[model samples]
Target chain A: MVLVALLTGGLFLPQWAMFIVTIAFAKALVALGLMILLRAGLISFGQALYYCLGAYAAGALGRFLGIADIFVQMLAGAAAAGIAAFILGFLLAKYRGIFFGLLSLALSMILYGLLVKNETLGSTDGFNILPSTLFGTRPGPAWVRYAVLASAAVVSLGLALVVHRYLRTPLGRLAPAIKDNEIRVEYMGASARYAVHVIYVVAAVLAGVGGALAATTVGHIDPDMAFWTTSGEFIFITILAGTGSVVAPFAGALIYEIIHTTAYDLSPNTWQLSLGAALLIIIVFLPQGLWSLVSKMSTRYARHP
Target chain B: MRKVLVALAVAAAMPAAHAQSVKIGVVTFLSGPAAAPFGVPAKNSAEFVVEQLNNGQAPAPYSKKGFGGAPLEIVLLDEAGSTTTQVTEFRNLVQRQNVDLIIGYVSSGNCLAIAPVAEELKKLTNFFDCGTPRIFEDASYEYVFRTSPTATMDSVGAALYVKDAKPGVKSIAGLNQNYAWGQDSWGDFEATMKVLVPSLDVKTSQMPKLFAGQYNAEISALLSAKPDVIHSSFWDGDLEAFILQAGPRGLMKQSLTILTTGETAMHKLGKQIPDGTVLGARGPFGPYAPNNQYNKWFHGGFVAKYKDEPNYASYQMAQAFLGVKAAWEKAQDANGGKRPSNEQVAAALKGSTFEGPGGTVKMSIGKGHQAVMETAYGVTKLQGGKLTVTNVKRYPAEKVNPPEGVKSADWIKGGFKAQ
Candidate 1:
């Protein structure tokens, strides 16, 4: 039903709203990567490392290599980011909490440094990619936007379902167990570190795919994609969404973009203040995040009905 | 009832005559790292020119009775956040706000992102002050045109000034923002300087991160390399920060610093610019612009309103506004006492030349729908407790600017037209 609405009802939205929702969906995909790890009680502050990789990879494919097919670029982006994560996961899974966060951050910063210094990839300014295409045919920007929107809706929903199923599996059930008591999980003959490594790789691929979609939608990418602040934003959305379900990050991402764009429109100079205050209110009132509120309201409605 | 219906239909038909102002969406950074120099000054200039046009106060040519008799209704949009956000905002400006035209962006990336979208939306656009040659070089658009020269022009002008003024200079060093804009400017400057003076040896080059705004290490490296000259294309807070740090360190005492697009921060730097430093205004911009009536009106009008001498961004804004107004007037003339469609305005802008505040800003039809204009060069000298650009010289556009589709590096390497 949500995918149907995204395809059908999304068409009726004003151009700005459609574009806004597209951006929201892109960010949500990245936030979902965080949401996966948050369920395991792990945080990656350098998610931008994968995000930038996805973006640059997709950008290079379209801009330099002349592959405008959206699916091919997205797959290429995901593969490149996944490979990087697979290599880095060994060192990362051994650590937890702040060590993990800081290490991820350091890794992302290294990418940022390399990108900023290299002029061929456009350095800080970055470069533009080819206009988005459906299969092999070039479409107008609006149609391309619609195509991205539909893809985002379907892919996010599929990822959510897959993640939901993963949670019920033996490996999936070990996530929360590892978070609660890693030593106990290890005592049960499971390597808690190996489980984390799997989760880490999963999140990395998700972030890469998200970055690819975002670059195609925006039609540009820069070192800013790999900047630590961008990673922080993903984390912000993860917190706002809560770890309740695979779908919360989608809602959180939408609300964040709406509030952010509106705040900036309302007060261009003091928008950051508005964003901070909103986050503060969310923390104080709904600590588990906007998703928890939804569950509460649904429960109340069901009982009354 | 029949007569009333006829009157209503006439009123609706001739909306332009009944004072429906030409709505323009102006996009500039109201708050960002670039706000100080590139954004605020540009916004102020646009506001000032629009007010003058609406009121029928600016001098001749620009004094064309409110955008060909349709007063401008201005909407200012803040350009901040990622390029995607800007692309969304641009669509909002066109689809949601129903702005007839858009003028925007200080970042080259923003301009490049918006250009294709603007063309897709079929909205007439004026990219006010972003300096990337890649915009036109990469693609051609019927609806998009930059009224000012790109970074290549500014870098070339700086190189020309250095060759003419600092005849004794042998070794050169570059300190530019590490981005496409910075690198492109360096490539053009380094290549052009080598052509102008073959013996000019490169001692050291630094590509600092954009908006890093701290240059202690970059400054130390420059001091150690000890080139006879240092060329930079830094702008906004970064340039101000560099001057603040490098000025006190006596780096200026060792080598003459050449600031490409330097005039934007003249007021902030003033005496701190150092006496022997060379600078270019990106074009015939700022106080160093040609002494013409259009410039006199602009300089005097801006100072009277803002209580500050107009910076390079201000002059460029004025020039863009003037170009837009001139196009509108030509469209109006073509239509014969009526409002022309956005397409007509774009058509009029093509291959048209209009007198800018500094000099003539003209479009070459064969040149990938891009505009080119002459550039102004100056040397900073401390006098009367402030830095003033002296020994100012203006170079012809055809001489300094590379032709359409020719990479600036290739052009400089090819000896700038002939042996």
Candidate 2:
């Protein structure tokens, strides 16, 4: 991936490569947020709500205070989104599976309706984002591209290591056990609600980070960031990557970006058909996704030895 | 029980006192991703206009002459995103508040749905910003009037611009939002292009569902089509997203990029737009070119009051108000300075020319009481990093109107000649 990035450097390749890479990174961050919830056996369809929450927070603060610092805006957004998740998460952690998903979706839609109804947030015309400055200086195009790439890489690598370390802990094992048999975990003296709430809040923060990054990349925000369709997209990312590793979301996001770019270029009208067909093929042939296919193939080769 | 009933009957029999302020209903999408560029501006314009209207300045173009000799009041309503919601809200506005007229409905779907309800309730409506030709094509109700041109009119202007500006252009491709406006725009442009430029080949046509946000795939396909020109009718965030993605990709650099609704995004894109890209307003450009007297009047007054240049949305809203004002003046003149009845006001609105900020618009009463208006085209460029439009051209409304009493053919059949 690093080598490919180097090859597609702004000096050599089309500028779109870097932009696509930046978007892929941001999407991976959002997908990673979903992975955290999936780890706790909680399905969330309101990730978009957190995404919008983070984006709007950043945009509003950036515009209102004349603070164009990317890091400061991101921090403000993450903090706001975290607070929102903590409050909304309390009610959300009680539900599980499809119920959890549906409830989250309903809550997000309610917020969507509010933003749409309120003229303060620009209603549907969307809020224009101030051009982000890193620290006190405005970065050039090359620097912005590099900064975005580095952010993606750091988030992906950092989150994967964190998730990997987390799974080694007894508490982390309890998450899946609670998913499998909550009664057994309860007998083991675990509070399922607290564990799930922690997971939800953590996932929201990660999604918030992703949303902030995406806002910087796209340079705008609107209520659609909190829509059910966007939440469904996160779920789609999860399903495409499977729940094996933290890296799965990043991988899936990359593949999805590639597919999106290529399919749109192939037949703009029929591109959706191409995307749907590809997803269908993946579901039918490799239910475990491309990553697991690699894992399965490696195991098969090792068995021959 | 009899005494209570008698008291209730007496209370109901007393006529409800009218508020000192004139109430105008403002409807548009207020929530969701699509609201940012479209709904927010619409609501802001309504607030700004109402504030100015009541401020006692009685601004030159929108002077206090229309409100039945009273101050005007705007009652805002959120259309959300459904026809059912619009219908219910329209009913509530007419039956409950007893508003004399309504002034806003941004989406064509919402306008089409609520227009009949306005007709049924005998309410006067100034349909602003809704551009679906279907709204005008399917009915002949007497109450509905649109201040803005339909998609058919606007798209035809775009086609004319392309022909005049890029005469050598052929193999055209399009990317539009998947809805009534988008569909009609591409359909109109293609048919008109075919009729005018015989050699023009339609290499690609794509409709991305509105608010898709991600445009990589479609962009790639459009780039590959390798057309000499590309036209898009994406509005609000859809346009923003497409431009953001395509700007860096050099798609705009490759083709004669024609944004049918580009004037709306001028403030946002500012100077980021590729030079020489053809852009235009769906109706009239807010900043009229030299020689348009009404444009000069509207622009000067709006800027003086608002302290900002009027956007296309604001212009469209002001046009609606202007239409109402014209109808009111005509009714007053005909009625010997007496306030005309609802029927008379409706008649004045239909088949009358109202001077708009862009230019004068003649409202043609269509099959569904759709008020079709004139169109304007322009060229876009980034001047000091803000989107700037130039070379505005005015097209008469009748040239783009579908043959009267006939539903629009799914495909337009014609040959093109260089206009």
Candidate 3:
């Protein structure tokens, strides 16, 4: 029902509204990946590495190779990120806690350093990519944004459903158990490192997809995508969204975008303060995040009525 | 009863007829590293110009109330985020705020990202600052216009100044920020120097990251090279910090340092900048601004209101507003004294020459979407505790900027042939 509403919202909503929703959904994909890590008691502070890789892959394709198909660009983004994640997962899965986070951050910054120095890709200023086309045809100027929005809605919902099913599987249920006691999970005849590696790659692939979509929607990419602060924003959204359900990240991302946009519009200079205050309020009042509110209300009404 | 009803109708109709206001979205860095040096001054200039324009207090040619008799309404937005955030904000400015026109961008990255969106939206947009030449050279736009000269002029003008001031200069080194603007500026200056002075040798070039405050290692490297000249395109806090750090080390005293965007730091860090340092304000701005009635009006009002001389950023902002006003009034006049559409205003602005606070700005490049103006560079001299520029050399717009259909780099590579 929510998916239908969002897809329909593309038709009637103003350009700005559609843009905000599209970006929110794209970032939500990254947060959704972060949700899996948070549930497993892992924090990867450098998810932006995959995000940047994905965006650059898509961007480079459009810029260098002249491939404008949205699906092809996204596939390239996902494939590139997935490969990088698969290789890096070996080293990353051996660690947990802050070590894992810091290592990820270092890796992302390494990419940032390399990108900032590469002059052909326009260096720090980056470069613009051609707008995406649907298969072989370009959408009308008025409908182009709607096309991107529709793509985001369909892809996000499809991935969310898949992740929801994954959460129901035995392997998926092992995340909380692994978080509680890794040794115990190893004693149960499953390799904790193996599960971690799989999950890490999955998370990276999701972030990659999100980055590509964002780049396509924004029509520009830069090394800032891999900066530590960008990764911090994903973590912020993940915590705010909670690991309650597959859909919670989307809800949280949408709410965060709305709050950020409204606050920025209201006070350009002090918007950061307002955003900090909102985060503080959320952390203080809703420890389990905004998702907990929905779950709490649902349970309370069921029990009392 | 009939007379009273007619009077009431006329009163209501009068308000309806005169209530029109042109909403313009003004974006700048309200909170960030760029806010203080470039963004705030531009914002201040916008506010000052709008207030004056609204009251018809501006000098001749811009004395019309507001834009073509329509009061100006500005919706300000911050330009502190990544390109994606800037693009989203640009859309919001047009679609959500319903701004009739848009102006402001201090970062070349933000400007490049916003240009296509402005074209896509068909909104009359003006870029007050942001010095990259790619915006016009890479693509063409009807609705997007840049009111300030590109960074090429600054580099070329600096090169000309160096050639004229230090004829026998030998080796050169660079300490530029590692970005497109810095890289492009250094490249142009080096290319121009090669064309003008064939014997100049390159010693070493250092590129620290943007906003990288500490330059100890880079400064040491530059000092060791002991080149005859050093060129840097540092701006904002980085520029101030470089002067502070390099002055005590005698780097500036040893080498004839050329800061392409150095005029901004002159007022605040005058004592720190060593004499003989060559500086440019990207164009004829700040100390190099011409002595014209419009400039006097703008400079006087800016100093009176802010209690400080307006920098190049402020001048550029005023130039953008004046350009808009000129175009709007021209379109209105052409439209038989009625409110003009954005297309009409854009048409009037294309290939038009107008007076800026700095001097005459010609929309002669980027197919008339980009501006070209005369640029000046000078040697800084601290005389009696007051920092003043001396031996200023002015380079005409045609002499410095690439002609309409040529890219800046390519044009420089081809020996800067006259069009």
Write down the TM-score of every candidate.
0.94, 0.55, 0.97
Model 2 residue runs over 4 Å out of place are A1-305, B1-20, B51-66, B288-294, B304-307, B333-337, B367-369, B384-386, B406-419
Q: On residues B277-391, what C-alpha lDDT tens digit does candidate 1 reach at each position? A: 7777788888677788888888888899989888888887888889888888889899996888889999888878889787788776235356788887878888889888788
Docking class of 2: incorrect
- Please give the lDDT score at residue A263 for candidate 3: 79
TM-score of chain B of each: 0.92, 0.86, 0.96
Each candidate: what lDDT?
0.84, 0.71, 0.91
Q: Which stretches of model 1 miss by more than 4 angstroms?
A: A140-142, A302-305, B1-19, B211-214, B365-368
Rank by DockQ, descending? 3, 1, 2
**How close is each model in CA RMSD to the real structure?**
3.5, 22.7, 2.6
Q: Highest TM-score, which number?
A: 3
C-alpha lDDT of candidate 1 relative to the true structure:
0.84
DockQ for every model, please: 0.60, 0.01, 0.77
